[model samples]
Target chain A: MSELIRDFARLPQTWFETPIAAIALTLAAYFVGVRLFKLMRHPSWFPPVVIAALLIAAVIALLPIGVEDYNRGAAWLTLLLGPATVALAVPLYQQLPQIRALWRPILMTLPLSATLAACYALLIAWAMGAPPEVLASLAPKSVTSPIALSLTEELGGSTALLMGALMVTGITAIFGVEWLSRWLKIRDPRLIGLALGINGHALGTVRAFEISHQAGAFASLGMSLTGAFTAVVLPVVWHLFV
Target chain B: MSIMRGLLWLLAFLLLGQSMVQLLPIPLPAGVVGMLLLTLWFVRRGKMNADVVAVSHPLIAMLALLIMPGVVEIFFVAGRYADQAGAILTALLVGTLLSVASSLWLMRRYMPPLNETDHE
Candidate 1:
């Protein structure tokens, strides 16, 4: 078994050289992860994204391929992020009447929540003795991945570390939001969705959709507005304070 | 075909958003600006087309998967920060929970009560 494992690892790198190989590997891993998630009854214990990422990570770790190579091959999928983000407006538009009615509250909540997200991350990380870069990365963890990555870049933080922090933040919001809402007696779908979107970003939006259309609409609204507010404000704040 | 049209709309808005970001003085993300632009267009039109809904549903559903590549980079990069992993994790957990709790608390306190017809 050890010899076989060594032989597999020593296989020619040419087989995995093409971008197709990378894309195929990602899709296969993600599908398998989704199957496992469903087989496990879709428990919050292992979200498909976490499973897929781990599987891909394991494969990349064992293979004789560099991170840059893998990322370059997978660039096509990442490029869709921008269009997908714009696609979010469909749901937001559906909920516009309600949003317009509550525009005052949402406008007020956006900056306040954005500030809280940045401050809580910075202060907690600072107290924990996190280095400056880690603190900067954490400051934008609550925003969507695309915007978060951009914010991290602007603030001179490590994009990879910010990605990890985001995964943690997203998973926590996915599993914890409901329990927290019940505990806090948050009954409104709008507020519940808003909390999840503000804290979890895209992952939280996915979970919010599972609850109801109304919840999903509000979640998209929260996610979009928070991303806008954070993207515009975080770099300036980071420069001034951190 | 309708999905294609819907995609075209998304792509167009994305381009417009990118142009706006480059032209405007404020530092805004193109994606968010595109979303806002689409929202305003939808508001002015007074209805959402089914084609946009058709395309957006699948896109949003698979949103998490689309971000996996970036997340996977963490595995490659996390080793450098191994010493600080515990601190990072602690901050993430505490900060996330606090942010969610505080946002929910504030929104509930300040937002007006929902109308009877709003329960949908």
Candidate 2:
């Protein structure tokens, strides 16, 4: 077994050198993760994203290829993040009437929540003695990746660190918010979705959509509005303070 | 063909968004601006076409997979931030929880009571 494993590892990289290999590997891992998730009855402990990322990370770690090479191969898929974000409008469109009715509450809450998210991240990181770059990267942690990466880049922070923090924040909200909502006895899907969106961003929106269409719509709204709010406000505040 | 059209529309919106982000002085992201623009267009039309819906549903469904590459990049740079990894992780956890709790509280406080039809 050891010999086979070593031989497999030593095999020429030619076999997995193409972009298709990277894309195919990602899809394959995601499907396997999905299967594992279902086989385990959708346990939160083994969310597909978590599993797929870890599996791909492990494979990339063991292989001779660098992260940049893998990303270049996978760039085709990542490019879709733009369209995927725009696609969020579909749900938002579906929920337009509801949103119109609740626009007051949404508009009122979005900026406040956005500010709070940034402040909490910055203050907590500062108190923990995190470097300024880390704090800046974290300030936009609740925004989705593309926007968060852009914001972090503009602020001269590490996009890689921000990406990791964004995922952690998202996964934490996904796993914990439902229980917290339940504990608080918050029954409205709108509120629940809003909370998920503001706190979790894209991943949280995915989870919200799983719960119901209404929840998904509100989550989309929350995510977009929060992204816009953070983009406009965080830079101004960061400039003033740090 | 409908999916193709939908893709084209999405691509056009994406292009417009990117251009606007560059041209504008405000700090808005292209994606968010695109979403807002799309939403406004839909609102003006007062309905979503089937083709748009067809394209968007699948795209949105696979969003997590789309973001996996970025997440995977984290593993490569994880060691670089090892000194502050503990602090970063703690801030992420605590800050996320606080954000979630506060947002939920505020939404609950301000959200109006749902009408009977809204429960549907």
Candidate 3:
């Protein structure tokens, strides 16, 4: 058969079309990203997640496989996000001591910080003439990726757009937290880490860990609570008005 | 804690959370609800099960890879974002900075400085 006889470079499209291939490729790319991240000594701006996405993009560009085809395998991974999100309880549990210790500050800071995070993003985007869909995508910008992606889906926002906003938010929060904390003269690692977590989510948590174990603990707490709070409250509030 | 047992526990909780969403009038996603319930479970026990931790560790760690499909959606939807990238970037930058500032201010201004030894 001509198909079996084809040269390596001229392989059939169907050979690249299997779900196993798609999953394998995705895993391989992500593995490559992790290796690269470690090799580079773990730069903040160049996360393995971002790197893997770019690699996947290159593969897509070079091949005839479209998103629909790739997603046949990836859809299972996406579905896994639900349980993965549920698994956020582990970090929250691990931070229980720190959470109990500073319940007051955590509580006082939560409603305002979480509300402002959503409002500022939405309002600013709205003012800048971003359409309603764009606003939806941006509404959960401060949330961690899993929660944000699910919320964006509920609101009919583009998850792709939300991902971009997430990267920007994470990068901005990482850079801005240092300057902001210095200006506020807040020497408390707990508060600084909480601010970082609430605004920046997982990336912020990683950065917080770099600051100190205490900061890292509080950051995980902050990231988890903000995620749950925004996820629960945003949908209710979103439906009420828009 | 074998991985199988750990996953079973996680899935059971996940089921509980999803059921709550369907039974109640909450607009929140099942995953968020599940996360809350599981936290509460951990609180009640005042400690974590090794099994749950075992399963959750990998799931959370692999999260970056899990969400890659969503990010790649940009390849298809770039047309929608082509005109507004600047506004979006500016909004994210300013919004994130202001958020960090306000949260830090609120905590420092309102939260009485508790000595580190107080919690013990």
Candidate 4:
């Protein structure tokens, strides 16, 4: 018993040793989780993000891995966002011909979608008797993270909630776009892009790629438009309500 | 011909965001502000093509998944929101319904049937 105790004591603490290695291991596990999710037919009930979350949770719980250690590695993946978001331009350009033809429809849809998203959140909150701050954060749920967070903070909503809401909104739209598009009979890539981008934020953009190159482009355009319109419109509406 | 020019246009849009983030009031985060600014650019330009359309898709697609890393921090803030989960869940459910319904309405309003477009 004493020997075993001594051997155990020799082991370094979670945060103390090989912090980078721990992060690398966690990220590796995340990659595996993503692959496994794909194998499971990318089941709607257990999405890639949800699966990743569960797998990461089990890892942290079962092992002595600290989050800080894991974050060090995973965060490097996040730095790709700036370039990736910019890269969406390639697909946007590819679909430009189709977009030009449907410019009239595209122009009208952005504001309508943005307005509905904002107003719907507000109306639902009012109906359910939610407080103003909650409504404020909810206001920007349909837009992307940066804008959603900004609006949440500005209206004194919980940034954390806004973040969570952003994730949920994005993920749902990611999965939800196909069904919505089919039901709506939307064939235009620009419209698909706009709807997903506006309504799904970033997540919809992800799903847009699975549909087609054009669909993906429109998703990017829509997302940017949604973010932009919501940023401006939400504030004007917030002032009116507050 | 203009496919390459679209690249320059995208660079301009991205830079416009970076520059304006510093200028915008109301503490709007720059990326979202940039996204908005980009939308205005699209509306103003009002032109599209295959190459032009393909430019931004992948970037946005990958970015959608970028939120995964942030979920780890949720544990830290989870406690503060525990009491309000009901409200949050309600907002999600209600908000989702409204989103789908509104999207459906808009699609019906603007888009003609695909077969009809081909016929025309």
Candidate 5:
């Protein structure tokens, strides 16, 4: 009986070491987050992604699993992000007219804002004496993951650090935009979405969807424009200086 | 199902993007190139591509879920960089706040009100 019970206890350990467990844990955490967000009446502070992360952290604390186990198996999830990011074209396409009509302001807003966001973080981090690697990672923090990620690698920043910074940027933008817009008495979804998309990147776009579809559409536009702008500009500048 | 068809179409675009990145000296990633290619393709047609839409809708709908793992990794990473944590946190917060505020102001200044354009 002791032998049989011990074998049964070890089964979960073996399974948790596999990729299936990692992927399954992620999906389960996310769905649980979704339900909880709804239960809490869709508060920004309790957004699904952050809640999901917390849930996964809880799993780590409760079980024998380490983040490495999940990291090893969960790389496939990162691959899926590439194609999903490409699908953003759908929203960009859907918002064509608004994009076409507001071309001037968007053209104006993107270059300056994208440059401002990147420069401010880089300057602050540098001034505060962050190591060069940290500064490099911070360089692309404002751009969406897919684009910023490639830049991060090219710039020799840590992917893990960039991922953390990217999340912080998005979550911060989501909370900050809501609060700032309210304080300034700004009501335009277009304006709010631009702020979110430009500052938050994809995460901001995700949050904007919760506000309204109009906001969602504009946010996607903001994200794509910012991504493209940074993709072109950052590398040339980096190569020139380095 | 149409879902598979949509994914296949996206894959082709992704592949094209991958190849372009290889052949050219562009700074853009394959996936972003893929997105821009599809967007330009749709622009020429001047409409949404139904096939892409089939996959995109579900993907976009679950985007938060898709992004969760990356965010989850933050838990593990936050501690490793604890030394620079304050600088990193302050920069992200202040930078994001200033960026958003300035961007919003610029949009409001340059563009007219929401009703002024066919934004929806």
Candidate 6:
């Protein structure tokens, strides 16, 4: 078995062998997450991302597996991100007519939402005594993954750490969004999903899908707009604070 | 058309990623720059290819799950923040809450109802 494993690792095929394990783990995590999510009545409190993270963390700790091995398979999973992001256009296109009707409100609110969120981050960081790197990393949490990772590295934060934190934040929001809405008695799926995506980031977007199509569309739009708004404004805010 | 459109957006997102790493003048994260670029494109074009959107949506979804591999790194940071956990955690909790609350409020105020036309 050890010799077989060695030979398979040595195979000239990085693609097939490397990502297979990660894919399997991811699928396992997904299956578990789905069950838990369903059992929980699909509330936002049971965010799949967070559950998956915790589960994966536990598995790695107990199994004696290396990240390199995990990543060998995980890397293939990363390839799906670009295509999945592109898929967001489908719901957006369907919602186009409604989006157009509500254009004024969206245009007016999105920037303000972005600014307020960034400002809050700045304020909290200022109050918290967080180091510069943490501040920089926290600054871009609302954006998508690829962009968020790049910003983390650029801003002198640990890209890996920031990525992890962003994932946590997104997942927490995704899981919590519905519960928050129900607790608050907020019924608008569009508002709930958009708010989650904007504040929760990618994790929120995933949660958005679990709800309804209209809600998912709004979440995607919010995610995109917030990213743009924060990209333009976060640095400016950082310059002022840091 | 489908393949070309997907490729274009993919290349564009990739370029945006590059720009975040390079062209952006801010002290912000590069990934944020790419996101900003994508958002700008959507805003300007007012439409994106359905195929492209389909392709990109899942990647973002997967990102949430992808974070598990980095837990070892988080354990390392836990030490650094340990001394300041009381403060930092407070700040994180507060900041995150405030950001979410305000963002939702503003989004609700500014965003037109979803049932409205897409041209807005």
Which scores better on TM-score, 1 or 5?
A: 5
Candidate 3 C-alpha error for residue A10, in Å: 7.7
Give DockQ: model 3: 0.60
Per-residue lDDT of candidate 6, residues A1-242 (tens digit) = 99999877655344335567667877788679768867888655546555765676566555546555665667677665554564455567667666667677778777776666556665676676877766676667667666567656656676655665576566556645655666656777878877887877767777777678888888888887777666666655556655
Residues A50-136 of candidate 2 have per-residue lDDT tens digits of 889889988888878777778888998788888888888889888887888888878887888888888887887898898888887
Interface root-mean-square deviation, each candidate: 2.0, 1.8, 2.6, 4.3, 2.0, 4.4
CAPRI band of model 5?
A: medium
lDDT per residue (tens digit) for residues B2-60 in model 1: 99988888899999999998998746678878988998898888888777778898888
Better of 3 and 4 by DockQ: 3
Candidate 6 per-residue lDDT, tens place, B40-79, comes to 5766777765656655655545655554444434543466
Segments in model 4 whose C-alpha atoms lie over 4 Å from true places: A1-26, A61-73, A180-190, B1-16, B24-61, B112-120
Q: In terms of DockQ, which candidate is stronger, 3 or 6?
A: 3
Q: What tens digits encode model 5's per-residue C-alpha lDDT throughout A1-242?
A: 99999898777579876788888989898889889989999887557888888999778767776777777777777677778878988877777777778888788878998999898888788889898789888899888887888889989888889988898899888988999899989998888988899899888999888788778889988887788889889888877876
For candidate 1, lDDT tens digit of each residue in A111-145? 89978987887887799898887887888888988
- Superposing every Cα of model 6 onto the true structure, what RMSD results? 5.1
Name the runs in model 5 displaced over 4 angstroms: A239-242, B118-120
Summing lDDT over every window of 10 consecutive residues in candidate 5 chain A, give the lowest-scoring window: A60-69
Compose the digit string of candidate 3's lDDT tens values, residues A1-242. 66656665455257555667777878999999889989999876677777887888889778866777777767766787778777878877776776777787678879889999988878788899988889889999989886788899989898788887887787788778887778777788878788888998877776786687677667767887788789889988899888
DockQ scores for all the models shown?
0.68, 0.69, 0.60, 0.29, 0.67, 0.31
Q: Give residue A230's lDDT in candidate 2 (0 to 100).
A: 83
Could you tell me the lDDT of residue A208 within candidate 5?
Answer: 88
Query: How does the DockQ of candidate 1 come out?
Result: 0.68
Q: Name the runs in model 3 displaced over 4 angstroms.
A: A1-18, A39-41, A145-156, A178-189, A202-217, A231-242, B111-117
TM-score of chain B of 6: 0.53
Q: Which stretches of candidate 6 lie over 4 Å from their true place?
A: A1-17, A40-43, A183-185, B1-77, B110-120
True contacts kept of each: 0.79, 0.78, 0.68, 0.32, 0.72, 0.36
Q: What is the descending lDDT order?
A: 2, 5, 1, 3, 4, 6
Higher lDDT: candidate 2 or 6?
A: 2
